[model samples]
Target: MATTEQGNGLAPRGTKEKLTGDRKRSDPEMNGGVPGEKPVDKYGFTGGAQQHCGESAEEIPIEVLRQREAKWLEMLNSWDKWMAKKHKKMKERCQKGVPPSLRGRAWLYLTGGKVRREQNQGKFQELDNQPGDPKWVDIIERDLHRQFPFHEMFAARGGHGQQDLLRVLKAYTLHRPEEGYCQAQAPIAAVLLMHMPAEDAFWVLVQICEKYLPGYYSAGLEAIQLDGEILYALLRRVSPVAHRHLKKHKLEPILYMTEWFMCAFSRTLPWASVLRVWDMFLCEGVKIIFRVGLVLLKSMLGSQEKLKACQGLYETMELLRAIRPQYMEEAFLVEEIIELMVSEKDIEKEHHAQLRHWKETHGDLHCKSPPRVHGAKAIMAAEPPSRQDLRQRPTFIVESPLAPQTDRVRAEASKENGKSKAEQQKTIKPPQETANPYFPPGDPSPFLNHMTVKASKESLSSAEHDTYL
Candidate 1:
């Protein structure tokens, strides 16, 4: 609810901005900008990129970025150790915000998406290659263009961005046929596609749907309705002012929070705030979503002057739809969200109370699935059922380049060509240790057998562990 302004890593308006070489470009396609554009923002998304609301991000020194990246890289390389022993430090770093370039990989790790992909090798390719169910296919295709129509990736109808998006969505329906496809999933998938490849996006979406926010996208959407009720109850404790205002109007949380909570606020918040919120959400879990909603409501309805302007449902709804620019600022919003005292245990307590009420009134709760542990951390700790049938394929790209799948195929071909096993063995030689994918190519980094690079899925399993990390 605090409206105090602070520098959001960008300099104040009218201040002399820092100069870094001609990072400028005139290409209109430079992030879907207008033709003849010649300016570029340091964030790589403004001006020609035009990715945001035309505001230039503050110039962060390159040195500072490098140091942060290194720290994150170290944490990523040894994530299991840190998660087991140094979790506090890891959580603190994630709160500050992940480096932009590393956001995709960080998400794959934090959401345990990479591990899921590893667990069910080639599942994405299988689902994507198969023709999806007609019911979900039509719905997914119709909804794809509606997601991020302004962003360059999805700006083109049926472009690769949309194509990739279709693959992910269709794959999800095939992956979990009972749940099928939901319209809100398109925007959430679009956000993931903005960062990762189609395959990675698919797995992350799975983690989001099945792990982080269970039953939200199911046929009845009972889980989201339950969550909406939970949010309303928590608002009573979070900001009684906001709660009282809603109570006075008989306003329902479902009216405002449906899109916000379902899409992870992607369709609602400004670009910067959305990304910052996502960084925390991937690491901490769905509690961050509740915290964000509580903050936005408190900021909008916290004070008498604000409440006076929103005396009716229409006015309050409009106020939420068009939130003040200051409340949505990245620096301001994230700080307030982190400062809030909401916890997963409290949300769970409310969830149980809400479920009990639902059963007492409506009977059965009509759940298609059972209850779940809802968080990225909890997902990692739980033991998912093994799929012995799906492990036939080799590990994802993390295989050693020296012995790629291509190499294995070639060796098999040689044997078919009447070559002796001894000859094939001599030509192949023993495979050296897996090349580390965590570091730059040819960077001479030591092999962390436990480490994994999602891009190559690079992993050297000298030792066995739950995940590559």
Candidate 2:
């Protein structure tokens, strides 16, 4: 019997003939692979494609993907109309998430990145061609690979991703020489590039630094510190247990929260959560950051398991750094953050209060004073806000049968007390040192002092009335 060659070019039977024909090629890689092209996995997606933490590309269904793409295109076509009239619907969709295929375009629309790109045409190239501030250039180069090292786009040294990141950073240094560049900006820029092209990414970064979070990346980082104080106040009200634990352990918000706020949680959170946060941050403003921070703190320290696991300051810090993936489930996390009820109004009110306190202590100082470091002290021993201050602002209403005394009654009581105005003022001490180490040291203004006194009197009266009841 004659020997024959197999289809794959192997000789058949017991024949010792050397098979000499070009080996049959394997099936072309899926997703339109070309011969000799970069190797791709079984799925058609390329190596450069981003893989969200805890999620695989292959798991997504093709039909669902098509629908997402279609929905995105429809939204893009009518973006102006959607923004003007269907903003609620648009916000709802964004909250759900911008589909991966359309995320870049959606972000562009959300941030008005396209308009900024058009306005600054050729500007990035011009800046890139110039020698950036040598200091920032070196820093930007160092950070390029540090960002998204696992992702193919940024994994390679001096690759297109890095080059784009460098150009964007260098352009920013030139764009705002005073601010120069900050390390936190690298991740923010890198995340933007992952979703959009470099120019568009740069513009989006411009919107973020300039519009969304003004004064955030500047030399002083005053806004960030101020926001940290604001977050502390919110946390105290939202989750007192967690707040007390952090204070007891001396885990100042600055120790952990600086990077969280500075990078907009890009470095702290899982990629999926980060993208979802960015979606809301783009839509809702910086308030989302505060809300997210509160949720993470409450989830991490609110429970016994997490608290026990984090016994010391170092352990607590580590726990915060390696946030459990379970807490980062985007839908659940976003919903929890939304339910936090930390409105911008609340944040603004706290900001003004903090600012007033800051000014009273350090008279029109441009630079923020360093936060005081306190040793172990009774958590309750921290000075409370003056009673008079509380009376002036009845935002926190205590339900009691005793109605607030009338102005006439208050005046008569003051007269009967026979205390001079100065003596009466002396009765109300200044706002005491805050238990929160993050709170800047300050004395309450005279007006705040008066409010504190009134608040104390009202509280005492309410207590006596309750006892009578």
Candidate 3:
């Protein structure tokens, strides 16, 4: 798959392009020279040849993989049965890693994407058919090429990868106009496109933004800005040394971690580690992201000698921006995260405390902003994406904690009295945590139970808003 032209050089006029089009400055000489030969990275990505880890996943014996995939297929076939009887086993397997062959199907099941898709048939196609908002469309088009240029799927401009990526982003804006389109979504959609088709990818992205990480891509990014506080709080307990260094340097979590969490670390970790982190993230929740960030911090600044290198905010920021090779190694990083003691309960507790602090400092978020939609399908259930359309679709109800439907109802009921309703609307509480089909009890994923937040104007900072990776 080696393109003739590479290294920012122009191709000879007669040298035909092997890729979908002529190579851009970002495109490089693909690792494998022979046509159709496997790229040095089994994932079909280039430019990571220098960063190859100690143990290659490709080295896993084919027989072992086939057996693993078989086991996964069996569990998938009887998913609910497995969840009821042996949920712990499934959760552990996810931590180890979903087989690459079954990653897409696994992700669909893990994120409840399959159920979501089934409930709302042809919804993606319908939204994709309609023209997207002009504001989002122009921005989406500009950011498409910046995602995973080293990966074959998005290597070419206007190629199916880029095309599919565009559809997914545009559809989300249409699906949840309140959230609009956030720049952090580009790399995330690109990663999803690599594994699943556009339709499935779109739904997974929905689950990620809405369910897994609520209010992340929403207007003021209140969810993530708040999580930044939560992460630092947990860091104090998990790694006191690292936390002290960050506090001394005044290196706010938002300064470096914004892009990391906003995109679910798709832009932060090595591709292999990114997939593994996602596998767990899908099963557990945002706590997986918190744990990963904590592990990186502990590794970078756990020791006095490590702190010696980071004297000021700039040095500490640089160290975080470019993580060392040892930390980036997939197996090592996942192992460290697993070994780390931080749990969903810990994250949940910190989130609740931070919520109280934010309200005191920022005032009532809802007071300033218009009536904002808390989550997607809750409203969609009450009203379809396009209720007035002639076509009919099933009522896609989401029993998600992120969507406070009952609160919305009570708010509406109070609307008959204007002044009283305004007082009542000071806060719209998030719903309580329900038993997740993906992670049953004893496993513990701390989402939906508390920490109500108000969304708003200072949405994403310039760095966060402009983050293309």
Per-residue lDDT of 80-164 in model 2, one digit per residue for the tens?
5555577777777777776665566567656665556655668877877899887778766755655655454565676777788
The lowest-lDDT stretch of 10 consecutive residues in candidate 3 is 458-467
List the candidates' TM-scores in order.
Answer: 0.74, 0.65, 0.71
TM-score leader: 1
- Measured by TM-score, how close is model 3 to the native structure? 0.71
Better of 2 and 3 by lDDT: 3
Choose the strongest candidate by lDDT: 1
How does candidate 2 fare on TM-score? 0.65
Q: Can you list the residue pairs that collide in candidate 3?
A: 220-459
Clash list (residue pairs), candidate 1: 10-58, 397-456, 398-456, 398-457, 398-458
- Scored by Cα lDDT, where does model 1 land? 0.69
Model 1: per-residue Cα lDDT over 1-469, one tens digit each: 1111121111121223211112333344333333343332322232321246454353357677667766877776666666668877877878888776567777877887777887777788888889989877876676665555556566566677789989999998888877777766778898887776677788889888877888887765678778888999999998899999998988777767777887898867777778889989988889999999999999999888889898898899778877887888888898999999999899999999998997887787565655555555566567542333112232223444454456565686666678777776778645453443322565432223223444333333321111111
Model 2: worst 10 consecutive residues (lDDT sum)? 460-469
Q: Please say which candidate is ahead in lDDT: 1 or 3.
A: 1
Query: How high is the lDDT of residue 193 in model 3?
Result: 73
Instruction: Report the C-alpha displacement of residue 170, candidate 3, in angstroms.
Output: 0.6
